[model samples]
Target: MRARLDAESRAAGFVSTGVCRPDAVPDIAAHLSTFVDAGRHGQMAWMAERMAWRGDPAALWPEARSVVMLAHSYAPQHDPLSDLDRREQGAISVYAQGRDYHDVVKKALKRVARWMVAEAGCEVKVFVDTAPVMEKPLAQAAGLGWQGKHTNLLSRKFGNWVFLGAIFTTLELEVDAPEAEHCGSCRKCLDICPTDAFPAPFQLDARRCISYLTIEHRGPVDADLRPALGNRIYGCDDCLAVCPWNKFAVEASDMRYHGPHRAPDLADLAQLDDAGFRARFSGSPIKRIGRDRMVRNVCYAIGNSGAAHLKPVVQDLCEDDDATVADAARWAVERL
Candidate 1:
């Protein structure tokens, strides 16, 4: 049953798959409590709201006997950090460069779950990152990979550029041994962060994280941290890009996930209205941030760009309807 499931998962476009009991993540509750209690999650109040389900998969679905974890790699062929040097361009994270992973990964999860049900005669439920399930720990427990010092899963086979999905089923399958941590003495990921978001190894303070500031965070960002944002207008991938384990990563099989959107011109992005923003990022994850938030990010990047040519664009945005966007634009104009 396990072997058949593995083959089905690969056919469904997942690069790696493994299984573990629903109750496999024993220390997740404690770890989560510590992280949240320390206010490390920043303004992501949803994490605190779903504490029970997020920490314990068994609690989420008591009927489930096993959890099958799957990983879909989206590694880039070129250097992910190379865009940082192009100060006039806005650096969007590699993950959001193409179609939204939520839509893509969810479709693949449904395919795998349907196969498991038809072949093994078992009831199943599929989950992507949208759910409160602790996917990384479950993946590590299933031998998919270990959580590196950056706190993201890292696999010898797929590196740090994989999207995780899961299938919970009533059928008990043979479980694989957990992958042991291989970070050793490496602190490359920790050192590369522009904002020093990491309080220590394997922990993150999301308040200072560029990804959180540009994406999940609402309202005005701190003036001091805005300068460090550089040209990254969307999510930041500094830690992930600097990881030594990424040497084993392969180019993504999904062609839709690779292209010029990786580094859009900051000036061009600054001129987008609400409708234009929607049309430009129709199928992309960047759409989730909405026009105002995205413009706010672009303004920050423009400020960091130091390109006098973008001063007019920034000055025009200073009268934006959205207060946050206007604030960011004013900040950018001052910098220019």
Candidate 2:
């Protein structure tokens, strides 16, 4: 079953797959502990509290003997960076431009897990960004890819376009050799960031990240970073899109991962009220951020849009009860 799944994954455009013992992650956890100790996670304090346990997968689940790391390719039909020059339009990350990946990836992992459990006779647990799993390191250990200088998992075949997920099981499976790092002397990901999110190579300062500020931070963006955000409404992919290795990636196989709905027009996005917002983002990850945060992001895009005509919409949002909404609205009005 394990061999079959690896073959299926490879045929589906996954560059690699490997079974690694849960213990394979202890060294990774120890290193990540150092990253947290150095205060690299910024305001995401959860990374600090789990310091002891986060460093080891065995500590995370004692019963798990093996972990199956999986990768799904989401190569964009066009260069995501190409739209950045259109300041009047928003540049949403390629992954978020489709159906929420949590739903899409998890469904695939579950199917694979069910097949494995039935054939191998063991308990199985699956995760795709919803748990305490150290996905990047585990993927590296599983030989799925190597950690790039930007600290994201990258592969020779897919480059940085793969989305990772994992399944941990009680059955001990054959493990594969870990991948070697291929980011020799490359600092492109660090240099291309508009907000200077990377403090140094391989270490990210989440607070300065446009993705963190626009999507995760629940308040007004730093006035200095607002202009750099341009019209990116949901999340920033400037760094990911610019990686030179992406040239090897093929276009996404899933039609849902393609087309304009994922990259909706910024002007249309700014007009969404609560109901409109929910309806527009029905099954995508953007819906999980709620109307307030989504609007907060939209207002930043409006400000960056230099679309003075949106002054009325910005003014109306000023009365929004959410402090984050009010603050962003004020910023948009000033920019307009």
Per-residue lDDT of model 1, residues 80-128, tens digit only = 7899999999888998998898888999999988888888889999999
lDDT of 2 at 17: 72
Write out the backbone clash pairs for model 2.
29-55, 97-262
For model 1, the superposed segments whose C-alpha errors exceed 4 Å read: none
**Deviation from native of the Cα of residue 336 in model 2, angstroms:** 2.6
The CA lDDT of each predicted structure is: 0.91, 0.79
Write out the backbone clash pairs for model 1: none
Worst 10 residues of 1 by lDDT: 251-260
Q: What is candidate 2's lDDT per residue for 77-181, written digit by digit as tens? A: 777887777766677878878777787777778877877777878999988987778899889888888888777888877788878888888988888888998
Q: How large is the C-alpha RMSD of every model relative to the true structure?
A: 1.0, 2.1
Which numbered prediction scores highest in TM-score against the true structure? 1
TM-score, cand. 2 vs. native = 0.92
Residue 174 CA displacement from its true place in model 1, Å: 0.8
